[model samples]
Target: MNTTTEDTDDRARRSIGARRNPASQEAILDAAEAVLEESGIGGFSIEAVARRARAGKPTIYRWWPNRTLLMLDVYRRFKNARGFPDTGSVRGDLIALLQNHLLGFWKDSLCGTVYRAIIVEAQNDPDAAKALYAYQEERKKATEVIIERAKARGEVAKDVDGRLIIDMVVSFAWHQLLINRLDEAMGSIEGVVDGVLMGCAGYKR
Candidate 1:
C-alpha cells in the first residue's frame, strides 16, 4: 500500500477529531450555556449547540450521548463554579448552603430553568431519570462529608443518618424551585436549617 503525505494528513485530522480535546470540550460547554440562556431549555438541542459551538453534531454526540447527559454536565459546571459552605458547624453550614449556594444558584434564571427542565424531563424520560439520580448520588456523598464533620464535633446525634437530613433540605429547595418561590424561601432558610438541626441534635427548641 502506498501512503501519500495528503493521506497521512487526512488520517491525522480524523484521529484528532475522534478524540476529545479539552479546548473543544470547553467551547462546546460554553456554547451550550449560551444557547440555553438565550433560548431557554425549549430551544436547547444538540443541533443548536453544534451550530453555536461551530463543531460537528458527531463531536457533541461523541462526548455526550444524549441531551440529558449534556444538560447535566452544563448544570454541574454551574455548580462547580461556586464554593460550598464551611461555616464550622453543621447548622451554620446548612444555612449557608441553602442561602448562599442552592437558593442563590436556583434563583439564577439560567440555572433555575435548567434544573426545572431537567426535573420535568426526568418524569417522562428514563435516561434523564437515571442521569438525575446518578448526579444526586454524587451530591449525597458531598452531604455525607458535611455530616461527618458535625459528627466529629458532636453536633449531630450518633444514630442520625446524614443522608436523611440532606434529602430533607434538598427536597425543600426543589419544592421552592418548582413553585417559583426561591426568593420567598430565602427569608425562611434559617428557620428551615434550625428545624433540621433540631432533628439531628434532638434539641428541645
Candidate 2:
C-alpha cells in the first residue's frame, strides 16, 4: 500500500481499538506520559511511547498524529483523573483549588515535568498554545463561578471582575510553583486569596 493509504488504515484501526477497548486509549496516554517525563519534549517519539506503553508503533501513530498531540491527550487524562475541588465559600474554594493545583504540580514529578514540556512547546507551537489557552479559559470560568457566588452573598463587590482576580491568583501561584516547591508556597496562597477578596469587597459595586 502507498504511504497515505497505510496511514489511513492505521488510523481506522486505532479508532476501532479505542471504541472497542477504552483500556487501549488509557494505555497509550500512560505510555506517552512516561516518554515525556523520561525524555522531555525534544526526545518524545512514537517508538519511545510505544515501547513504554508495550503497544505497537503503528498503534501509537494511529491514535496520535504527533508527539505533541499525544502529550496533550495525556494532560487531559491526568487533569480529569484528579478531578476538581469545591468548597462552599469563594475563599475556601479558591484555597482548595490552588492547594490542589500546587500539590499536583509539586508532588507529581511526572506532572511537573510534562507541564514544563507543554509550556516550552506552547512557546513555539500555535496548536499547543491554543490548547493551553483553552485550559486556562476553562479554569477561569470555574473561578468566575466562585466569585459570582460570593457576589450574590454580598461577600464581594458585584462589579468586580472575576476573571481579573482569577488571573492574578493564578499568576501568583504559578510563579511560586515554578520558582519554589508547593510546601514552600502554601503559606502564601491563603494570604493572596484574602487580599484579593478584601480588594474586591472594598470596591463600590
Candidate 3:
C-alpha cells in the first residue's frame, strides 16, 4: 500500500488542525525561512514551505494565509528574539538599532533576505503592502519608545515628532538594503543619528 500525495496532505492538515503545538508552528516558520533563503521570493510558496516542513498547503494556509504574512512572521520572529537596544543616550540607542539592523542581522543573517523579500512582495501585492504597512507601524511604535525615553531625559525636543525621526532612520536603512550597501551604511549610522537629533534640537523646551 502506497500513500498518495493527497492522502499525505490530508493527514498533515488534519494533524495540524487537531494539535497545533508551538513546536509545529516553529517548524513551519523554520521551513519558511529556509525556503526564502534558498529560493528567494520568486521561488517561495506554500507548497515549497509545506514540502520543506513536511506539512500540507492547507496547514500552511491555515497558519499564515499568504506568503507575505508568512514572510512577515519569519522576519518578526527573529526580530523579537533579537529584541531592541537601550544604550542610555538616544544617539547610542539609535546607533545600536541601526547597527543591529544594517550591520548585524540584516547583513549577517537570514533577516536581510526575509525583509528584502517582504519589500519586494509589497510592491506587487496590495495585501502585502497593507501587511507591510501594519508591520512597520508596529515596529515604529516600538522605536518611538526610544524617542520618548530621550524626551524624558531632555535629550530630544518636547515637540519633536518621533514618527518623523523614525521615518528618516527607517528610510535610510531601507535604501541601504535596497542598494545592497548595508556594510557601507554602517559608517554613516552615527552621522544619520546626529543629523536627526540636531534637526530635532530646535524643538527642545
Candidate 4:
C-alpha cells in the first residue's frame, strides 16, 4: 500500500484543521451560526456546516460532540456578547438586560432563532431539556444576584419575597420571548420591573 504525498497532506490537514490554523475554528463557528440562523436546528448538520465552513465533518465533531452541543456553544457566545447588565441600580440593570434580549428577539436576530429552536428541541429531547433548564437556571441566578445586591444596599424590602421576585423577573423575560411583539412596545421591561418591585418591595413610583 502506497500513500501518495497528496493523500498524506490531506490527512494531516483534516486531522489538524483548527489545531494548525485557529482561523479555521472561527470559520467553522461562524458557518455554524449562519446555518442555525438560516435553517434553525432541523436543517443543521455536521456535513452541512462542514461544507459551509470548508472544514471536515470530523473537525467539527472533534470540537462539539453533537449538534445540540455546538448550537449551545454558539448561543452561549451570542448571549455572552451582550451579557447581563450592571448599571448600578437593580431596576436599571434589569431593564438593560431584558431590553437588550427582547429587542433581539423581536428583530428575529440569529440568537433569537437559535434560542427559540433550543426551547422547542427541549420539549422532546430530555438531554436538551436538561441543558435548557440548566441554562435557564443560570439566568435566574443572575437576576437573583441583582435582588440580593438590592437587599444588601437597603434598596429592597426585608420582607420582600426574594424567591418570588426571581420568578417574577424570569417568567416575565420568558413571556416576552414567547410572545415577542415589537410594535411600539414602550418601556416594557421597565413596566415589568416597576410593577414587580412595587408589589414585592413596596417601591415608591
Candidate 5:
C-alpha cells in the first residue's frame, strides 16, 4: 500500500479540481479578474492568478484549458453585469444599450483593455475565436429577446427581423472598436438605433 511521491503530487493537483469546490473556483476567477483590472492583460499570468487566489497554477489550469479559456470567464462576468435595457421605448432601450457599450469601450479602463486583449487573441487563436463568436451569438439571441419585448409592448412591428437588427448593432460596435473612434461611435448610436428601428416600427403614412 505504498504511494510514490509522484502519486502524491498527482493527487494534490487533482484534489482542488476534482473536488469541485465552488468557492475555490470562484476565488480563482475573481483573482484573474482583479489581475486584469489592476494591470490589464500584460500582467495577467498563471503565476499571478495563482498568487492572488492563493492556489496552485496547476489548480487553475486544470479548470481552464488555457489562458484564453480562462479569460472567457472574466469577459462573461463583466458582460453579465449590464443586462439588456428595458426602458419601455424600443429606441430608448437600444440607445441606452449602445451608449453603455460605447462608454465602456472608451471610458472604462479595465473593460477596454481586457476586451481589446480578448479581441487580439481571437485574431490568432481559432479556439478563442470560436468561444468569442459563440458568445456573440448568445448576445444576439439576448438582443432578440429585447425585440420581442418591444413587440409585446406594441413599440415595434411584429414582423421585425431581430437577426438583422442584431447584425447592424454588432457591425457598428466592431467598426468603432477597429477604428478606435469611440467619440464618433458614441455620437452615432442614437442615429443608428433610430434609423434602423424605422423599418422595425414600420413606415408612418
Candidate 6:
C-alpha cells in the first residue's frame, strides 16, 4: 500500500511538472535575455542561461539548440512589443516610427544589448545575417506600403524611389542609434520628411 501511494504521488508530481513546462520555456528565454544583457553575447552560454532561469540545461537545449538561436527568440519578444505604427500621414508616420525605435533602443537594455550582439554575430554567421536581413526587409515593406499610399494621395512625388528613400531613412536612424546616444541622435521626423521632399518633390511650398 505504501509503495502504491508513493508511485501515485510521483505520477501526480510529474503531471504538474509537465503542465508547467511550457511556461518554464518562456521563463528560460526571459532569463536568457537577462544573462545576455548582463554578460553580453561573448559570455552567453546554455549553462549560464539555465542557471539564470533556474532550470536544467536540458530544458533549454530542448527548445533552442544554441545561444544564437536563443538570442533570436529574445529579439523576437522585443520586436513584438513595439508594434508597427500607422499615423496616417507619411511625415507623422516616419517621425513616430523613428521615435519609437529610438525609445526602444535607449529604454530597453535587453533589446539594446540583443541588437548589438546580433550586429556582431551577423558579421560572421551567414544564418544570423540572413535573419537580420529578413527583419529589415519586412520593415521596408511596411514603409514601402506607406510611401505608396502617400504617392496615391499626391502627398509625395510620383518619381521618387520609395525603396531608396526607405533605405536612407533607416540608414540615418540606425547610424544615430549606433553611434550617438538616442538623445543626441538627429532623428526628427520633420527633418527627415523635409529632406526627402526637397529631393523628391516636383513643387515647393
TM-score against truth, every candidate = 0.85, 0.72, 0.82, 0.72, 0.82, 0.69
TM-score of 5: 0.82
Off by over 4 Å in 3: 1-14, 18-23, 37-43, 200-205
Mind giving the per-residue lDDT tens digits that candidate 1 earns over 1-205?
Answer: 3656676556544442544655556678888999988988889999999999877899889888888779888998888777577889998889878876688788854788788888988899988899999999998778677788999999877888889988988999999999999999999898898887764465565
TM-score of 3: 0.82
Identify the leading candidate in terms of TM-score. 1
Least accurate stretch of 10 residues (summed lDDT) in model 4?
15-24
How far does residue 42 in candidate 6 sit from its true spot (Å)? 5.9
Please provide, for model 2 over 1-205, each residue's C-alpha lDDT reduced to its tens digit, 9 standing for 90 to 100. 3446566556645543433245567667767777777787678888888788767777677766567667777876776666656677888978876777644444555666566667678889887788888877886786578788878888787998988988887887667656756666777777878887775555787
Model 2 residue 66 distance off true place after TM-score fit, in angstroms: 3.2
* Global Cα lDDT for candidate 5: 0.75
Can you tell me which runs of candidate 4 are displaced by over 4 Å? 1-27, 37-42, 62-65, 102-108, 158-163, 182-187, 200-205
- Per-residue CA lDDT of model 4 for 18-56, tens digit only, reads 343444555777889888778867799888898888777
Models ranked on lDDT: 3, 1, 5, 2, 4, 6
Query: Cα deviation of 51 in candidate 3 (Å)?
Result: 1.8
Better model by TM-score: candidate 2 vs candidate 6: 2
lDDT, candidate 3, 50-155, per-residue tens:
9998777887888776988898988888898878888899999889889985455699887887788889989999888999999999999988888999999998
- Identify the leading candidate in terms of lDDT: 3
Among all windows of 10 consecutive residues in model 5, the one with the lowest summed lDDT is 12-21
